[model samples]
Target: MRRVSAISWSLSVFLLSFFFHLLPLSIWSEPAEPTPAEWPPKFNALLFENSSGKLHVIDFWYDWSRGGSLRITQNQLAKLTYERSWDNGTSYLYPSEIHSPCWLMHIPPGILRPNWMEGAIYHGQQYVDGFLCNVWEKVGVVWYYEDAVTKTPVHWSWIPFPGEQSVHVITFNVGAVLEDVDKWEVPDYCFNNNNKLENDEEMKASAF
Candidate 1:
């Protein structure tokens, strides 16, 4: 069973967000302390992660307006699904995942921290999903694309090897427009525990 516990997924989200934002800190030789008022812009994204041969797909959504967030994770092999959100009093559709949204931080500038670009191979410009982007690559991480105009990371992956190599890719700016507010709601089906599915073969087989 390649099931990832909720704790692990929550930790991955935190760690990935940290790595993405840390580029800015590394770019500046000497950076001034960041303040809450200067937080980065709010946007939604779709994160695709491939660990070894297993796959995990996440529909990641965020909005700074009300500090709202929605994350839907699907485990391809196990057929497990879970959702975590922070809209009305922070909640989770399944106990597997927790509501931890404070860990993700957005930094200003939104460009590749040049200092970390050492030995990074620039593949020039290319189109990804209809958007033109500048590509770059380095071991353990690959910059699939960066928005040509905004210079923001559109597609990238982190290949961290714990036991076997795990590839984590994040696709930013998914929906052309911000998602509907109600989309963040806990579906009525999830209101009752009867619909909850555990990460077991039997449950997984019938959940869908």
Candidate 2:
């Protein structure tokens, strides 16, 4: 009777070990990070920017096919300005308003694509601006957050010298292209200026 009982106990233990080994590995492993969704070829968004306490509202238009981006900004003083970047390694800033004589400088395009975030370190989920977001950090230079459900960008922040600046997407409209083509035309004065303007630190932070 004792010998029979010992054999039964050993069999039970072996069966338990086999069952555990057959369980899926995922049960004990961390979930894989999700890939970020690609931005639409043509889209626009209303952005609220907070740069070390200074605030601005921006109407941002992005057109990958045209290889250009336009940012129309209204600063705290209710003054309007424009900044346009082209793939041709040039950017123009109309400091005062549209049609204003703009300052031209060399600035490469910094638009984000899906693959750009491929190697970014995922930080899991967090709440940002009242929305639950999946966050990723890239090269310790910037933190990007996307809405967990919609996959739309919620916010992004970068550290520039002296401070960190953040931009939040107030509204995003995909497949929305600027109807006014003339809005993208570079003012003649922009090309006429012989001197190139130095890149602003704020502008550098806003890239990407």
Candidate 3:
């Protein structure tokens, strides 16, 4: 009877060890590092932004190959504004109501490439904007979040030298291009001012 009891206990221990070894590696390993999905070459998105306590709703159009990005925004006061940035380091800001003169500036490229977040430091995962996201920080200037399951961007915050701005992506339409070619053309009024922003100054400005 004693020998039988000892054999039973040894068998139980061996069975437990075997079961544990059979478990998936993912169960025991650390969570994998997060990789941000590349932005499509041409896409459109609606963005909600909070910039230094000011709120804005923006209709954003991006065309990487053309090296142009257009942002049409309605501010909290319901005033409409348009901003256009190009790869040649030119940007135009105009108001729809013509209350203010259009402003043009020469600066670095205001748009980033698809692999902008490549090699960014992954800060692990968290719940942001009600979605489970894999977070990453790029060059200590931007915090980017992408949904873990869908791999779509959920939120991103820019911490520049002067202030911080957070942008929430309301909607993203991949492969969607703006059909209106005329929208990419800068208004003639913008060339009137011909202002230029230094590289350092560009850092203080928003880049999307």
Per-candidate Cα lDDT values, in order, are 0.52, 0.81, 0.84
Supply the global lDDT for candidate 1.
Answer: 0.52
Instruction: Output the number of the TM-score-best candidate.
Output: 2
Q: Mind giving the per-residue lDDT tens digits that candidate 1 earns over 95-157?
A: 233331112112233323323445567677878767787776676454545667776655655
Count clashing residue pairs per candidate: 0, 0, 0
Decide which is better by TM-score, 1 or 2: 2
Give the CA lDDT, 0 to 100, for residue 8 in model 2: 100
121-168 per-residue lDDT for model 3 (tens digits)? 999899998999999999999999999999999999999877789999
Identify the candidate with maximal lDDT.
Answer: 3
Residue 132, model 1, lDDT: 84
* TM-score (C-alpha, index-matched) for candidate 2: 0.78
Q: Which regions of candidate 1 fall more than 4 Å away from where they truly are?
A: 1-40, 77-82, 87-149, 154-171, 174-180, 188-208
Which ranges in model 2 have alpha carbons more than 4 Å from their true place?
A: 1-29, 96-99, 199-208
Report the lDDT tens digits of candidate 2 across residue range 28-63.
898777867777888999999998888899999988
Question: Cα lDDT for residue 172, model 1?
Answer: 57
Q: Rank candidates, TM-score, best first.
A: 2, 3, 1
